[model samples]
Target: MATEALGSQAAAQDRTAGFGRLALTALRAVGRVLGRVFGVVRPVAWVLIAATITLWIAGQSLGWWELTVTAVVIGAALLLCLLFLIGRTAYDVSLDLNRTRVVVGERAVGALTLSNTGTRAILPSRVVLPVGNGRGVFDVHRLSPGEQAEELFAIPTSRRAVVKVGPVSVVRGDPLGLFERVHRRDEPVDLFVHPRTVLFDGQSLGFLRDLEGLPATDLSPDDVSFHALREYQAGDDLRHVHWKSTARTGHIMVRQYEETRRSHFVIGLSTSPADYRDDDEFELAVSVAGSLGLRALRDSQRVEVRVQERALPAATGKQFLDALSGLEHSRARAGGIVELAGSVAASLALASVVVLVCGTKVDANDLRTACSRLPFGARVLAVVVSPAGTAPSLRRIGDADVITVGALEQLPLALRKVLA
Candidate 1:
């Protein structure tokens, strides 16, 4: 009898567990239904709907005429709103940009095209396009079957940035502003507003003129550029042994060569906002870095441009400029120019020339310290951009030559002095 009682209790518990699971499933289904219902309903409409139901309940329970009348009015208005959202829009939409890349202060033009692809006529509606932080709303007229409408829009390019234009959406709503259904049309496009760069005579630069290879002061035993013969070291290669020099000196000698390094130009721009007196100075520094990078690309030299965060792509002129457009300055969370130099040294160990771009707020001592972190035999040039109206000047701090540029126009002259 005890065994039978235990079995009966287990069966009861199993039935209770199954009932609980069914209850949870029902709740999930109800939630999904409510989610779909609320997707097209605005927040204000939800409040009005709740108020209507409450008033109706209160009026029926307390027999209040005024509350019942108000509830009826709200319910009627909601039903009217539902009538406006009855039809679905079938549209063929496309977004076209005249140019995805522009310079700062230039205008970027784009067009949105919408066609009625349905068998019936469609009512007038509003189309919304998200442009960066702002929104553009175009009133699309009623389109008949096989009819199309086009709208032109311009994006502001007042500053250097990467602006996202679109994921064009068609907005359907009622006149009461209580309901809306948004259908996304096209993929977003990125608009690159590149920094203004100055063109200069790149061939005149001492470090860049060498096309074959630059002969470094450091000596290597198995290099192509022979320097001089030296007494054989313990680990010297046997092939490098100079028999003629050994016969003349009566001792073993080996051929030593100066290390030949392919010209690699690296531009390190500081992204720390504190390094600049203001935003204008930071922008000038960016332009300077861009000018140097473009010149390097023109020279067909291997160029790497980077900030405190990551290296910018420099494969082509357009890519380099596009990456520069999105460059921004922030606080020095990962240290400053010294850390950037270390990173470049690690990534490009054979850099022949390294240029450090910063603002006037960075002192000479800091510039020297930053330059000290570069790879050995790499010639370092530091460009310190100042605010407009200051005269361009050049100075040597430790091994790095620091050029102070006041404006974008002064960059060519400042670089010329460095070459001189």
Candidate 2:
């Protein structure tokens, strides 16, 4: 009897748990259906609906003619709002930009074109285009069948960035802020606002590289620059065997060559926020690095640009500038110039010139320490970008020549004076 009683109690408990799970699933399904149907309704509409229901119930129960009339008026207004949302729209939208790349302080002009494709006309609606953090709203008039309308918008550029400019949305709703329905019509676009750069004579800086790279001291079995003849080793390639030397010396002789220098230029730009005094100083540092890299590229030299996070693409002028336009300062815990130099040294073992771009917060000791981590024969130039209004100056650290640049325009003059 006792065992039967325990079994019955367990059976009842299991049944109750099963019922609870089934009820929860049903409620979830109902909630999702309601969410889909009423998702576009505004909060004020819901409030008005609830008030109408409550007032009608109270008025009918209390025999108050005034309450009943007020409820009817509110209900009529809400019903009229629904008519505004009951339109079918078939639009072919296209977004066109005059140019996708621009320099700082230059406005980016774009046009949003809409055409009515269906047989019926499209009612007047609002079009919203997102440009970076802000948005522009335009009133699109009624577009008849086969009729096209165009709206122009200009995004102001105050800083360097890669601004996302589109995914144009057409909004349909009443003017009373009751209901809204949005349809995405176009794809997004990226507008690159390149950093300001100055052109300087790279050869005047004495960082030139020969067409055929200069020979290094390291000897290799296979290279272009011949160093000397040596006795043939076990793994020596027979193609490099010196027949004349072998015949004269009566021994197996092979040709040895010195490794040629890699004439690539490297730019290490410090991105730590703590290293900069303000946003302007950081921007100046970025511009300084960009100017140096552009000069190197114009000179037809290989360039490798790096920041605290990673190395940027420097294959062409456009790619380099696009990458630089998207750069932002690193977090507080990010490394400084010393760590940046270390990373660049590890990634690129050989370079003709390594330029360190930083702010005035970096001291001489930091520059010296950073210079020690670079390749032995590579020339180091540390460019310190200070706030505006400060005089430009030049000095030499232990192994790196430091140049203080106050503004962007002073970069070319400072580089010529310091490096020449």
Candidate 1 residue-wise lDDT, 171-238, digit = tens: 88899989987778979999999998888875424354655487888888788888998898798899
| Pairs that collide, model 1 | none
In lDDT terms, which candidate is top? 2
- Of candidate 1, the 10-residue stretch with the lowest lDDT total is 203-212
Q: For residues 34-62, could you state the per-residue lDDT of candidate 2 as single tens digits?
A: 88669778999999999999999989999
Residue 323, candidate 1: how far off, in angstroms?
Answer: 1.6
Q: What is the lDDT of residue 22 in candidate 2?
A: 99
Q: Name the regions of candidate 2 deviating beyond 4 angstroms.
A: 1-36, 202-208
Tell me the lDDT of model 2 at 215. Answer: 84
TM-score of 2: 0.88
